[model samples]
Target: MKINWKLKLGSRKFWALIAGVATSILAAGGAGDDTTLKVTGIIGAVGSCVVYMLAEAYTDAGNSGGSESKDSAAE
Candidate 1:
């Protein structure tokens, strides 16, 4: 089955998993709380934008035709 990029990108669970893993890795490397928090926040912020762009591209291709912004009620 094809992954729903939009849903995955917006998923709190997905983001939480990413944060957890990053925190674990940083902690294992003996990073301080401040560094870990800052890195995690930056990752989440940049990741949000990147995932959104990728998902739009993916779902647009999935529709296979016109570039209608169907999900956006205002559009």
Candidate 2:
């Protein structure tokens, strides 16, 4: 049976999402007093890595496609 995740999560996920957003606000405001800077730094690092990997993959695919076209043209 396929369960509807949105219906199952409902308000629980909604509240949790809200709390997460609020926590981010506090961290951005520099009010954590504990792990604010560390949390933000970790998030930034992970985001940057994800973007870098995606860009590299796309560029490699494009390069491979161009090489194939050049080979076909020369044949």
Candidate 3:
């Protein structure tokens, strides 16, 4: 199957958003008090869930054979 770079890139953005949110949560937690910890943890959990959901959606959208690129590029 031919790979669709555009769709793959869109999926990458969703993952990137998740990472950015997680990073922000971590930074907030490190500098925060108890309330901050709760908020940040919640944010991180929500962000992680969003990432997982997006990954599922992306996978359901179809593989597009990007898995081959991912495997070969590492070799």
Error of 3 at 61 (Å): 1.1
In the range 1-75, model 3's lDDT, one tens digit per residue, is: 999654554464655665567667767667456655576566566656666776677796666568777888999
Q: List the candidate 3 regions with Cα displacement exceeding 4 Å.
A: 1-32, 63-75
Instruction: Locate the minimum summed-lDDT window of 10 residues in model 3.
Output: 6-15
TM-score for every candidate vs. truth? 0.54, 0.60, 0.43
lDDT of 2: 0.64
* Candidates, ranked, TM-score: 2, 1, 3
Which digits, one per residue and each the tens of the lDDT, describe model 2 over residues 1-75? 998643443434444454567568977777865675565555555555555666677689999999999999999
Order of all candidates by lDDT, from best down to worst? Answer: 1, 3, 2
lDDT at residue 64 of model 3 (Cα atoms)? 57
- Tell me the spans in candidate 1 whose CA falls farther than 4 Å from its real position: 1-15, 59-64, 67-75
- Per-candidate total of colliding backbone pairs: 0, 0, 0
* Candidate closest to the true structure, highest TM-score: 2
Best by lDDT: 1
